[model samples]
Target: MPFKNDERELTSAIQAIQRDPTLRLYAVAKTYSVDHRKLARRLHGMQPRRDIIANSRKLSNLEESVLVQHILNLAAKGFPPRMSIVEDMANRLLATRDALRVGLRWALNFRAKCEDPEVIRSWFELVQNTIAKYGINNADIYNFDETGFMMGVISTAIVVTSLDGRAKAKTVSQTPNNPIKAMSQSTFIKTRIPRHQNSSPTSIYAAVNQFTKGASQIMHQLALLKAENQNLRQANEVLSKRRRAKKTRLRQGGSLSQQDAQDLQDERDVVQQVEQEIRASGGRKPREETRARRCGKCGGTKHNARTCQIEIDTSEEEGSE
Candidate 1:
């Protein structure tokens, strides 16, 4: 319905929203899109600062990583990347196009590195502008992008044929993963976590995704990995079954068949042969001897302290006389 009057229309919508007891303030985005700032301006411009609600819960280590991601995303989207707190929300509450550009600029360039105080303040203005343009208080307004960082470029080369002047047959320069970038914090891109799977896919065709878009590149690589994983899984399953079977046999006092016994003997022989081969390759063989008490005087292993040969020899001449 064409708004009967701008003020009347806004007031009606606002009233309806207020009247809906079950409707939540943060639960909707369209509600914040009405440019209430303009409406208030016409109505005496009595801009009042109202407290906005921000939700938070205790975060574990993993949850903290998620929250860091969350903050980074908000920072990317031109939102005030404030800690979980309630405060007066302005620019984002009344979003505008110009403001959104500023926010994006800030995310991409300003926040990427440390800057002079004045530069940071100006960049903050950019962020505010982005928030004003977008008017997205809730988290749904932002988009995510995953950028791959590959390391090696000079290691290989490919030819590119061109049809136009200065663009014809040529080689391209490549940047490694650790390539240098400007030091300023503002000149950064809105980077999101490289997700293993889509957090929110737009369609039923799950396999037909951006990740699977390049059939020759991504799909082929993933296909090889998938095949390898399946092979390993199959091998693991076989090994597990064998181990369980062995345990069952041991529990039941199972006896080996003639062929199985022969196989065990063959395995034993192979191990023994290996050991013998190693020994023959100049290794010392260990001796097996009975343990016996030795006499301290004679350094012998068999005789005890009494009646030792050394003790008898000491009285040999006296005995002869």
Candidate 2:
């Protein structure tokens, strides 16, 4: 009986012969358990039987490798190729190769043969490793799901048009918050025809336009000025009350004398003046001049008695005398 052997066994036998040119063919054949004549034929560059070969694909090995790589690339971009897309791509590839177009059955069979669990696992691991290597976090990654709209139910024709000669007509209502409801052309024409026949042409064209940008700006300024005027009136009332209280306290012989009251009024006036100046200038008051501190002992502005050079020299002179 002839020895039956697979491609791997035959390939190993050929490699053994290549590695050691002096390697005995019979020994190589014995090691692989294949026929010596078959091994010799393989070594001479003879192709193996179709059943013994690993690849039985319609596409060449190189072409299939390319297809697998393209699929992986699409998967990495979060757009994994679907069966229909794969079929289209395969058909295109086949057309370039002058091969017959493939059907859905072929696509199903191709997927069944190539979609190995191991390959999927490796692809997932590769994506994870790449993300980790580049220090990518969950926040940096994004997923985009596709959405589609159905056009069958939507009307393609224009549903509304202005009855007037104007290309567009402005509608205004006393209630600004209410949304305008859309109406079809037929409903609008039917409803407006009676009103239009009775109404004058001037009335038909007399739609109120929206307030302009300049008008809105003027209204805002007016509101701000009203608030400021109210604030100023309140401040004047408070100042008047304070003045009245001071006069009453003076008449009652309070602890404060008239001169003291006058001084207090002067201080309040100065503060009010500073506030007016600040408001007019639209800025904070200027920093005050810092007063030089007087000495506790001699009332000298330069130095205190503890560190006074003049006092120290005078004491030394008195000791010498």
Candidate 3:
């Protein structure tokens, strides 16, 4: 019967061989409960058969290395991508190479292998040490941090309205007026409402009788205003409930709003575009046309020294001497 040996067992067998150079392979294998042939292969520094490794991925070593580099670059750019985003990028790369499609398991394994916790901790320590040595302040650190272009871009606007249509007109407007001017106009309109003794019911009744021609019109307007005020109160209550629910959802990291979802999608698209640009550039920087001039003689990044008249004159003087 064929036996299976785990990494720990194999490692123990290798350690036994290292500790006792004169130890036989069969003895080491027996001690570690592994195969004698596997121990012999390990002692001979032979790699295991790739086809027999169940956890071996479909992506080639070179392709996996490139993907890992791409992921690290993105993380350094302050866009620590999600697994879904990584999977999408991987799928695109695989499709181009006509490789097998990757699943969630593959993505999980890729992350586990590429982003080892110990390696990440070492990188963190290095960064912390560098920061301490430089005595960098928060502002300087922020300047160095790479952020998305749409970091603070507005995604939505909220407009409150009442069913009775009066507040609706005030809330939703198309007039291209300055916000301050519009707000002042709204304040002026609000201030016109009676607040003193004139606002009393008895006073209003006396005024209605005195202005006989406008009595019916004034009563009708009062009825409409009362209905509008009731509608506004209800609308305010609904808005308050919605605000509370939104806050609760935000605290729990629940589903996003339509605008927020759209913004995230836009950011993902921007990242994809950047990745495509990087790929198209062949992983090398695009040469600057303005700084293309270089010295042909010494291969320096300055002026061409080969056809210089000054050098020609100096050469002629030396020849004459």
Candidate 4:
């Protein structure tokens, strides 16, 4: 008679016969509804047909399992690889066989086929029947938009580690009082320092940590001060430019409007405030070479047009010529 059951049933029958010495192969086969001859053949070290077909594929069972684990890892990290990446992985695995090529749709088809439609249908049916039996309303049901993961079922975790195996990284513990116990759990350390009320290895480590933290805070404050100084310098330069414009207008015999005079007064107040701030911060105000007095007509420093020295010198030279 033809085999009445699948490979799984045949395997179970063989296992039953092996477990109980008294149980005959024919009886076990009959109980499982598998062919007695096929069960006997499998019991006698015959490999399953599926295993033979799997051996002919590009990736072995072990390699496939590892790749699936890698995918799950990336998914857990919220950066699951796309189908194209999976296709590339397949191509790399089949690199030894130049003639064999993996198609672009291979990964998608494999993923779709992995999900059992019967299992999914059963799950939905179970949920619907429960809701119907309990008389639950739609308002009571809630759906979370985020991905859900089962707690404690996943044993793997992602961690950062150096590539070198010999390099050891020290872990700082939040529990300073129990540093010894915590450090002992993670690493083996030989402590030469004797235990005392005030002085211990843990106390030294804690003190160093506190000092490092304080230094970091001080550095941060210094950075803020430097930035504030830069901002003040920029504001002062702007005010200086405005003052130059005002002086130029006044020198050209242009009367300042009320608004212009108010603006000039506001600029003076701001400059005084900036100077006070610089003095309070123990910083010297940077010299502004742009604000140096220069004659408008000759563009000469140290003398204005009213001083009339450069013009007099040029006139005497022209007269002599």
Question: When superposed on Cα atoms, how far off is each prediction in RMSD?
Answer: 26.7, 32.6, 37.6, 23.4
On TM-score, the leading prediction is 4
Give model 3's TM-score versus the native structure.
0.24
TM-score of each: 0.21, 0.26, 0.24, 0.28
Residue pairs with clashing backbones, model 2: none
Off by over 4 Å in 1: 1-218, 247-252, 285-321
Measured by C-alpha RMSD in angstroms, how accurate is candidate 3?
37.6
lDDT of each: 0.41, 0.58, 0.58, 0.60
Q: What 10-residue stretch in candidate 1 is worst by lDDT?
A: 84-93
Question: Tens-digit lDDT track for model 2 on 65-139?
Answer: 445545555565555555665566566556654887776556545631336799878867876887789776654
Question: What TM-score, to 2 decimals, does candidate 4 have?
Answer: 0.28
* lDDT per residue as tens, model 3, 1-321: 355668778877798778888988777777777888877777788766653534546665445544554555555555555666556656656665477788765654563233579976986687688779977665545523222122333323211111122211226432223546446545543454455445546544443343432333333334434544676799999988876776677689898889866755786789887876786589554435435877766566655786645678878999999
TM-score of 2: 0.26
Better of 3 and 4 by TM-score: 4
Total clashing pairs for each candidate: 18, 0, 0, 0
